[model samples]
Target: MQAVLNAISDPTRRAALALLQGGEECCVCELMTRLNASQSRMSRHMKMLQDAGLVIGRRDAKWVRYRRNRDLAPEFAAVIDAVLAAERPLEEDMA
Candidate 1:
């Protein structure tokens, strides 16, 4: 889907996806800190991923926590897995 592809096209969103890939629910504040992003920027990135059905979020009081959508269609899951796999080396290279 175009939305899914578009969501993953942004490096920031891809990094966010990598964080969520661990299967733990991550809070927006944590993402903000980890990614060195502002609250509004992280929210927009999360919204994009959520709109693509790549992630699901729940309200935790004043914050939203997110995780990868466990029920993704097989095709989308495949794409996400491949992207995350590909991203690992790039991250390591940067580090």
Candidate 2:
């Protein structure tokens, strides 16, 4: 739970989660482009999210495709849902 909290504490990671919340798999490049982040930075963020079990990544040829972990524990999922809901206004403002 601490790891999950730590992971979502970053705005970048939260934005990434928002993107993945739709259930579509997104490539690292897509995330980088959408977030206006560099490759290395986005990679690190994705690594943290993966380590926290908030997301899963698959090697898609030369890139990694990521999506939210549908298998999350109910507690963790609830936490994510709440955070995303709270962050929605900020997300909309950014968009």
Per-model clash counts, in order, read 0, 0
What lDDT score is found at residue 51 in candidate 1? 96
lDDT for residue 32 in candidate 2, whole number 0-100: 97
Candidate 1, residue 33: Cα displacement in angstroms equals: 0.1
* Candidate 1 lDDT, 3-80, residue by residue in tens: 999999998999999988989899989999999999999999999999999999999999899999999999999999
Q: Every model's Cα RMSD, please?
A: 0.8, 1.3
Residue 53: error of model 1 in Å? 0.4
Model 1 alpha-carbon drift over 4 Å, by segment? none
Best model number under TM-score: 1
Candidate 1 colliding pairs, count? 0
Lowest summed lDDT over 10 consecutive residues: which window, candidate 1?
83-92
- The segments of candidate 2 whose C-alpha lies over 4 angstroms from its true place after superposition are 93-95
Candidate 2, residues 15-92, lDDT tens digits: the string is 999999989899989999999999999999999999999999999899889999999999999999999998898768
